[model samples]
Target: GIKGQSLPDHYEIDSSKAKKDLGITFIPLKKTMEDLIVQLADLQTMLEQS
Candidate 1:
């Protein structure tokens, strides 16, 4: 039996206004995750050096 339970997903932010008013571009989830990983790694390295 599975111990962990899955929670229902929801959207917190409305993207339509960002696109129409702010001219923000949507990034793919995969690419966004990759970029976050890289940023975290860099931050860790900086912390270790300090």
Candidate 2:
């Protein structure tokens, strides 16, 4: 799992409009997970090299 600042206890998104209008894009979970794994691997490799 990843950790970082979270949203406010009371948060909401107006789904009435298209997400793009709100400046948000839809990314599939599998793609996101794969990208995150690659990023972590790259970071780890850089750390080990240094």
TM-score of each: 0.53, 0.55
Worst 10 residues of 1 by lDDT: 1-10
Predicted candidate 1 versus true structure: per-residue lDDT over 1-50, tens digit per residue: 45696755964877999899999999999999999999999999999999
- Model 2 CA deviation exceeding 4 Å by range: 1-16, 20-24
Candidate with the greatest lDDT versus the true structure: 1
Which stretches of model 1 miss by more than 4 angstroms? 1-24
The residue-level lDDT of candidate 1 at 3 comes to 64
Q: List the residue pairs that clash in candidate 1.
A: none
Across 1-50, the per-residue lDDT of candidate 2 in tens digits comes to: 34886767996867546775776677899999999999999999999999
Error of 1 at 45 (Å): 0.2
Supply the global lDDT for candidate 2: 0.85
